[model samples]
Target: MTSYVVSFPIRDTVVRSDNNIPWVLAMHSNVVSIFSCFRRAAATCRSISCNTGNDLSLWAKERVLAPYISSERRNRIERVLENRTRNVVVVLEHLHSKGNENAVYRSMDALGFQEAHSITADEESEAGQASGDPRTDAGARKWLQIRKWHTTRDCLLHLKSRGYQIIATAMNNRDNSSLPVQDVDFDNKIAFVFGAEKDGVSDLAVEMADVCCFIPMIGFTQSFNVSVAAALILYETRMRRIRMFGRNGDLTDEEKRSLLVEFYVRALTSSKARRVLQKYKYDATDSSMTENI
Candidate 1:
């Protein structure tokens, strides 16, 4: 045995060189190379993690928020989403009461209807509506999507393009072929058109209507208030739809996935919740927007 000696420490393990300088040098080089690879691997992992955490996509927000959601709230979100529908909807034609508009929204939300259309008295638009919150309704509307059309014709035409039959409402006397509200066919994709009690249904709306309907009455009042009419009609439609299709809602799997993420993001409600999302790089500005219902 030679007397030459050297020390190479790795994890406090000292390899005895046995006085072979070339072997010692090779072993040291290997240790250094191994450590270099380990450091590279660790850096790569960190970079991937950082990029994933900074992603602001809805699915990314969902991934970050999933752990924070309580089982109860998650299940509630699922239940509500399961019952909501975009198939059947309502169209308001220049209703006089903004309060009535809010009330209509409340009814729609309470009935698990997801979308509504309206004819804005002003020259506005009815496109790309993702939410609605009217101060007049005591914050009763949820994340209910509303689209407003400037004219009744435009609203009717848009609905027609989407394969929806425009069912306009008026008293039975206004149209000879007007069916009772309950008697009307709810099987088809429908957009129920309601107008203010004072002015009644628009002449243009009646002309564009695929079919006309009127709520049955036995009392002295010839017509129900617009808000009352919405509640009644929506409740009836939801019930009839369930019976007709044997399902609570008609949203597809893809629709459910999209909506589920939105509901999850919306549930990050409290200020404390906002801070939690911030750590995950979520945009907190969206959290400030609270929907009604």
Candidate 2:
């Protein structure tokens, strides 16, 4: 008999088994409400064969743990995930202000973009938790994923590897061939790159970008702030996507399922979560759901 263990924040894991392990559980003070459900569920699930760590994790999350989340919360999560788009990421190059980055993320959240990458000037940069305008929320920041890279080349390379078309933002004076922001076509997954407060993107950014775009302005103030540029470009791209597809979001079924699980776990593991481990209500008849995982 073999055992499969799936543990998160892996500490104080209790395994109940001899020849085979029905449940391999790791509970903690933080997510105790989540994993503790497995203890009671284990009794009915003993006949359940050993599943790989991911399989076990999914089952525990969807079957054993998810129902503890309230109906209102579940509906809200689904509604948000419906509009979530996996494409259209943003990149910030050498942006020093956390307030600016936070503002960008708030825009990203509103526009249904899920992730952003930052090419920091150095490893010491902490470009998050803005305490500025649009009133950035620290908790809302957690709803979006922000990754920072130490160099422009590394960030661009990673995005390229993932099939992103790098759309660098520049002024009309800076790049003669750049497309007007609203007119640019989004034929592929995109990474819209914006630069710092005083300076625009790095030379490498312009050189590596697959396409260049700039906002059209008639005023004497020829440029937009970094955050403002990001908002305009992101909003235009998002609206165009909605018009092209006739909806605000285009997440696939698999993507929606994955995000749903994550959202459920996030809600369940929070400090405010109270009731949990509802008397082993899992149905063995729906065993096929675990097989797909």
Candidate 3:
């Protein structure tokens, strides 16, 4: 799926309504435009999808609903959807390493990725202890506690299996110097990986990546923090996709349904709820209902 950075001009209050079906429909229209642009520019672009704060909020709601639904049914639905829109997956990995989930959350919020799937080692450890199913629990453990270097490696392998070219951000290398951030071709399914603070990306990450890119910097600082680099790269990719394709490089209708279901399953949680409420408070809105409840 081709991923686009959507810029919806609607107010937050309007988009956050209980009956947000209309807003969703409108947003879908905008996404269609982005998809169209992607198709024209990068004929090889496979699917198109979007990551947004509002969509993530919906996923959090699904988390609340999970326990109420039959696990078999829920899992069936989630798996089906995940498969359907498996083309373009955006990950925010090792973001919690900074010891401030809130900072990472806010950065994702700014990127309109309110419902991005966030897997932490602690959460995975707990899930492992709670589940009886070895397969499910094992998967959770892998997601939660894998070594930092392995995280990027696994991501690259997983995406490549699904026919994606992994593009990662780092200081430019000799072979990658010709392919700067601006020169990257989004015509193919691609995954852009960002590493954690201090160490930047691991050697494995750079090695596994099909292309490495660097953001041209002017300041004395050698590099941007991981989150900033992510935003800059994602924005640039979005812009390039739009310019090349015009508005059509997006997911298929089937893909959209699948992604929304998967996102909803991964994102619905008490932690996410608390995060969203805190966001409202930080923005100086009245959140008494959320708090008192």
Candidate 4:
């Protein structure tokens, strides 16, 4: 169960819901293309999941429903699927917040990441709010903050139960003095936990991480944003895994199929737009869905 983490851009259609949709969508699409190219080159891996902040856009949703999309869209997706042979899951964090969630959704549309599963904060919290016309306390909002934290925790726990180590990006007693990013062995299933923007990883995330690592920096900047940090670390880790273990560093064929099916179901059902997955064969007993926070 070797896993790699990637961040997804918001979708374009989502941005259009706001006025600045086009520009935001374009920016994220470029980012998605760049990562897709990297994943293409690193064909020996499977991106277990991408961590997105809330905002599920139409374009982003298309990526998840790729397996069940029209032949044309499926072909486009399959073309990029080359070189990248693993099924990666996308996890959205704290994306339910008003402004950030909207932006993130637009970003996803631009990036072409489909919505799989969303974990929100509790239903009663004041922060559990949504952004839309006549914004009111409909009690329908999900508390994404709580969801994001617990999702990471559960992901780590699940991986650990399967015998994988959990590593986190954080400053430790030995910063840069510890093992270089390239030296980390990623053959075993591992979860790389990251924190929010203003703050580095949460103390809980740091404590839960089996090993805390920091990236080597030379400039005046003390740290990188959480998303950027995650991207860099995932890239480095993917490279190390490929160089060290080759294809064996990735998930088994069985796991890949399972993940693909799992994601397919979620993405297709994310919105009422598509139902193509209804024809596919899936295990009804597979309870891979994460618990709502």
Candidate 4 overall lDDT versus native: 0.42
> How high is the lDDT of residue 58 in model 3?
30
Tens-digit lDDT string for candidate 2 (93-162): 8887777878888888887887778677544464332233457534445555567678999989988998
* Candidate 3 structure lDDT: 0.47
Ranking by TM-score: 2, 1, 4, 3
CA lDDT of each candidate? 0.70, 0.69, 0.47, 0.42
What is the overall TM-score of model 3 with all chains considered together?
A: 0.46
Over the full model, what C-alpha lDDT does candidate 2 score relative to the true structure?
Answer: 0.69
In candidate 3, what are the lDDT values of residues 1-293, reduced to their tens digit? 21323234432212212222122223344566544544432321111112244333333334434564466766765443332222233444555343332343343333322222332355544443222233222222211212222255565676677687777677865564526688887788766666657766567767887888788888999788775676677567656666876642354564444344444334344565446544533221222111110
User: For residue 284, what is the lDDT in candidate 1?
Assistant: 52
**Residue clash pairs of candidate 2:** none
Error of 3 at 120 (Å): 6.4
Clash numbers, per candidate: 1, 0, 31, 25
RMSD of model 1 against the true structure: 13.1
Q: Write the per-residue lDDT of candidate 4 for residues 1-293, one digit (tens) a residue.
A: 22233233434311222221121123444676655544442431212122233323323334445645456644543432222322222233334335433333333323322222233456523564334322331211221111233355675565566565666666663333335556555656555555455665555556666776778889999787554565566566555655665632244455334444444443343333343322222232333433321
Strongest candidate by TM-score: 2
User: Which residue ranges in model 3 land beyond 4 Å of their true spot?
Assistant: 1-88, 91-150, 174-178, 259-293
